[model samples]
Target: MSVYQVLERWGIKNYRVIDKKAIEEITLGASILATGGGGDPEIGLLWTLGTLARGKDVVLIHPEDIPDEVVGASVGCLGAPIVLTEKPPSQNVLEKAFKQLSSYLNKDLEVVIPFECGGVNSTVAYAIAGELGIPVVDVDGMNRAFPELHQTSWVANGSHASPAVSVDDRGNMTIIDTKEDNIRAETIARSAAMAYGGISWKASYPLTGKEIKEKSILYSQSIAWEIGKAVKKARESHRDPIEEVMKKLKETREVDSFRVFNGKIVDIDRDFGGEATKGFSSGRIRMEGIGKYKNQIAEIDFQNEWLRLKVDGETLCLPPDLIAILDNETGEPIRTDIMKYGYRGSILLIPAQERMRTKRGLEIFGPSYFGYEEEYVPVEKIVSKKGCQK
Candidate 1:
């Protein structure tokens, strides 16, 4: 069905047709929101752009616009972000996963949802939607990216990622149905990715429209779009993109954003091809203070995504909250997959969305889940206590 036909049949009045420019903007905003994970945007951008060039329609609809019974699932790439840079996904990888998951579920998906918001993952849903003639939902499991499959608003709010389907480029497929054990599903999925040479495209987390409205991050796609639009305008007008991002967040998300540090990367310690770190990019980065932060040091640890941030031995940001290292001049995210020494960036921190602050959310992806001994603390609290402004 055509995009208009789909919306009309569903009786949805408010919708947007995503163009190449919009996807590019969404990718940029989602890359920052990815908090240093989500792999590279270029891969997803190129795929999505190619889809658009083929005259396919990518329609985005709000959760409320659909019926309560409308079915959907998430589509994304899983594995080490760095490995994705080496082995870009082949065409039709996610399509195979989507089909397998739908067949396993015995239901036709009416829409596509992003597993997380990141560069490649953010665009995956749109590309698939365009391919399958389905609309893409503005909702997502995680407004930002996380490394593991279990870390999602869907799992935190009583949905399961069971009956998930993962596919590798060589046509190898695995259907993981852990029922309610999302953690086990995550482990199995990771193992599959490692076995497949480090990356797999996946379709999982089937949910109803009502479940999505209740359990997922609402309007997340729009949030990323607005952030991207704001940054684009800033670049065009010669204004500071980071400042523009903060303003846009205040307007759209009503959240406080902080610039916690300014520095140049001094060292990166990574573990690749290790059994303990298989299917993941585990690393720590150290930075030398610059500008007003002179003489101080900043450090961040990551498992595909930035998990913790500390400045001179004082912890400022923890898991579930957001940590983004962005270029000072362009505000483009300095992704962990492509980070290098001598790169300059300004650390930006934003509070995780309220949905991710639930008690179950903390248990799954918060500080303690990441092996931090400290309890979970809100980013706003840390910023207020320390005055994280420059």
Candidate 2:
């Protein structure tokens, strides 16, 4: 069935059509939300653009618009972000995953949802939807990106990512079924990526419309779209892109975000090579303050995505809370996969979505889960107590 026919059948009238410009804006916003991870946007953008060029319409529907029983699944690249930059997916990788998963379940997927908000993952869902003649939902598992598969609102809210199909560029496939064990699913999936030479595409989390509406981060794609549009407008008007990003976060999410630091990278200590960091790009980065904040120092640790932030020995942001380091002028994110010395950026910190801070969430992706002894603290609370670094 056609996308419009499916939408009509579901009585979902309030939906948006995704075009190339929309894709660009969404990718921009998603990359920032990726928090130094999510791989290269160029890979996903080119793939999605090619799909659009093939005369396919990518429809985006709100989480609330679908019927209770409609089935949906997530499709995106899963691997170490740094490895993905060197090895982009082939044309049929994601397609193969979807086909295999659908065949396994003996059902047709009616919608495509992103597992997280990032450059490549954000756009890959659109490509999959266009390829399958279905609509992509404007929601995701993680509003911000994380490295592990189990670290998502879906898992936090009692949903599972099991029975997932992981496929490599060369057609090798691994099917992971852990039933209710999302963590085991992640372990197996990670091993598959390592076996596939550090990158793989996955189709997972087959959820009904009701589960998606209740368990996923709702309107995440819309939030990303508005953030991207704001940055674009700011650039076009020659206004400060960081300021625009803060304004848009408040306007869209009503969250109190902070510009934690402005600085240029001075040192990088990468923990690459060896099986320990095989499926991830782990590192620590140091930045020397600039402008009004000169002489102050900021440090961040990342494992695929930015995990912790400390400025001159004071912890400012921790796991689950977002830490985006964006280019000061263009508002583009400086991903861990591509960051280097001498790069200047403004660090933006936003509180994790409420869904990501639930009791189960804290136990899964919180600071302790990353081996930090410090407790997870909300970014707003930290800002309120310390009054945001000047």
What TM-score would every model get versus the actual structure?
Answer: 0.98, 0.98
lDDT of each prediction vs. the true structure?
A: 0.91, 0.90
The Cα RMSD of model 2 versus the native structure comes to: 1.1
- lDDT by residue (tens digit), candidate 2, 1-390: 899999888777899999999999999899889998888988888889999999999999989898888888998877787778877778888889998999998888888989899879888999989998999999999899988888899999999997899999787999999999998999999899899988889999999999999999999999999999999999999999989989989999998899979999999998652378868889899999999779999999999899999999999999899999999899989989889999999999999999999999999999999999998889889878978842
Query: What value does the lDDT take at residue 269 in candidate 2?
Result: 93
Model 1 over residues 1-390: C-alpha lDDT tens digits? Answer: 776787888888888999989999999999989999998888988998999999999999988887899889999988888789888988999999999899998898888988888889999889999999889999888899999998999989899988899999899999999999999999999899988998888999989989999999999999999999988998999999999889888899998899989999999999753468877889899999998999999999999999999999999999899999988888899988888999999999999999999999999999999899998889899889998872
Candidate 1 local accuracy as lDDT? 0.91
The regions of model 2 sitting more than 4 angstroms off are none
